[model samples]
Target: VGTLTFKDAPSMVTEFAAVMKKMASYKHSIGTGDTNATDETRVVDGKIYLIINPVNYYDIVARLTIQNANGVFVTNMPFISPDHIIQSVDVPVNKLIVFIENGYDATQSQPEKISEYKETFAMKRATLYAIDMLGNGKPVDNYAAQVYDIAIPTSGGSGE
Candidate 1:
C-alpha cells in the first residue's frame, strides 16, 4: 500500500500523472520482454479486484459509476454478501463514484440516497484498492481504502 497522501486535489493529480507515466514506461518495457523491468504494476488474469465492504444497512446497496476513456459506465456494486464484496474491474479507470441507495422497488425507480463519495483521481490499471467503509474517520482506523501493487509470479502463472 502507498503511504503517500495529498493535501489537495491538484497535488494529487500531479502525483498520479507522474506515477502513471512511470507505470506506462514499465509496461512498455515489459511488453518488449525486458526482464529487468520494474515490477511496479502487475496484471493478474487481466483484471484487478476492488474489495468493497459487505456490511451495509438492510435494503441499502452500493452503486458505482466509473468513467474511463471509453465513456461512463454504471453498475450496482454487489456489497450484499461476502462472495459478492470483491468486484473485478477492468483496467485504466479514470474516475470512480460510489454511493449508497435504498428504497428502489423497480428497475427504473429512483432510490433514496444515503451518502456518496467521488474520487476523481486516476486509479492505476492493475492495482488493488481495499475499501473499508466502516473504518473511516475513526481514531483507531482512519483510512477509507488502501492501494496495493500486485506481485507478478516468476513461474509465468497468474498469482491468484
Candidate 2:
C-alpha cells in the first residue's frame, strides 16, 4: 500500500464572504425550519472559517486533520461540533488542506490513519456527512450541489 496523502481540489476556493453568505442565506431561507439557534456556528479568522454541523453535536464523532504546507496540525484532536474560529501559524492559501476520517468508532480507529480508505469528502455525499464541517458550514453541498472552490484562508495578510 502507498502512503496516503491528503489532497483537495485546487479550484475549490471558498471565501469568507461566500461562506457567511451561504450561512446567512440558509438561515434566511430556513428561518422556520431552524430548530436550534446554535444549529450552525462558525469561526471566521480573516479568510479561514472553521464550522461545525448539528450532527456533530447530536451524533457521530468525526476526526478532522488540517495541516499547513509545513505539515503542522491546525485543529486539535477529536474535533467535535459547535466549535468555531480556528487560527494557527501562517500557511499559504490552498496549502492548508483538510483530511476528515469519519464513520467508525474512534476507539476502533486512529485519527492519523487516513490510508484506511474509511471515506472521502466526495464519497460521503447524501449521508450522515450532511453534518460535517463543510456540510454544516456551507449548505451548498447539503443540497447535492457540487462544491469545488473550498479556499482556506491564511492568518497573515500575505496573500500568496
Candidate 3:
C-alpha cells in the first residue's frame, strides 16, 4: 500500500479530475506484452510499485494493468505463486491503475485477445448497509456501514 501527498490539494484535484474525464473515453491495455498506450506517458514525481504478501497462506496467480498519467498503458504484470511484486515501467502519480477482475488469457507467452478493466464513474455513489434482527422479531437497519476496497489479485485455487 502507498500514500499520495500533494502540496496543493485543490489544484491537484482539479487537474486530476480533468485527466480522469478524458480517461473515461479512452481505451485501456490488457493481457501480456508491451502495451496499448496511444498517448504520451505522463510524468510524475515518483514511481508506483506493488508489494503483495500473503498472511498465513500463499497465492498462486495474479495479474493487473497499470496506466500512466498521460493515458499510456504501462504493463500487464503477472505474479505467480507465493508472494510477488510488480513495478510499473512508467511512473504513476496523476494516473489510474485498474485491478482487472476478469477476461485475460495467461496461457500463452503472449496474449491473443485482451479484455477490459474495471472502473468507477461516480464518487460516493456506493453505500454500505448493516442489518440486525432482535430476538422479538424486530429488525434494525443502520445505513452507517462503511466499506473498503481491497484489491488482492489471486489465482483460482491450485493448478492441476
After superposition on all C-alphas, the RMSD of every candidate to the true structure, in Å, is: 24.2, 18.4, 24.2
Cα distance off (Å), candidate 2, residue 118:
50
Q: What are the clash counts of all predictions, listed in order? A: 0, 9, 1
Model 1 Cα lDDT, one tens digit per residue, 37-142:
5434432221212332222211112122346587965433221222333433432222221111221122423444344334445344444344433322221111
**Which regions of candidate 2 fall more than 4 Å away from where they truly are?**
1-12, 15-19, 26-71, 76-82, 85-160
Q: Which regions of candidate 3 fall more than 4 Å away from where they truly are?
A: 1-5, 27-107, 110-160
Task: Name the candidate, 2 or 3, with the larger TM-score value.
Answer: 3
Best by TM-score: 1
* Candidate rank order under lDDT: 1, 3, 2
Which lDDT tens digits does candidate 2 get at residues 7-75? 222221233234334433222234547665443433323223332233221111112345779998564
What's the distance in Å from true for residue 120, model 2?
53
Model 1, runs deviating above 4 Å: 27-160
Q: What local lDDT does model 1 show for residue 130? A: 46
Worst 10 residues of 1 by lDDT: 95-104
Q: Which residue pairs come into collision in candidate 1?
A: none
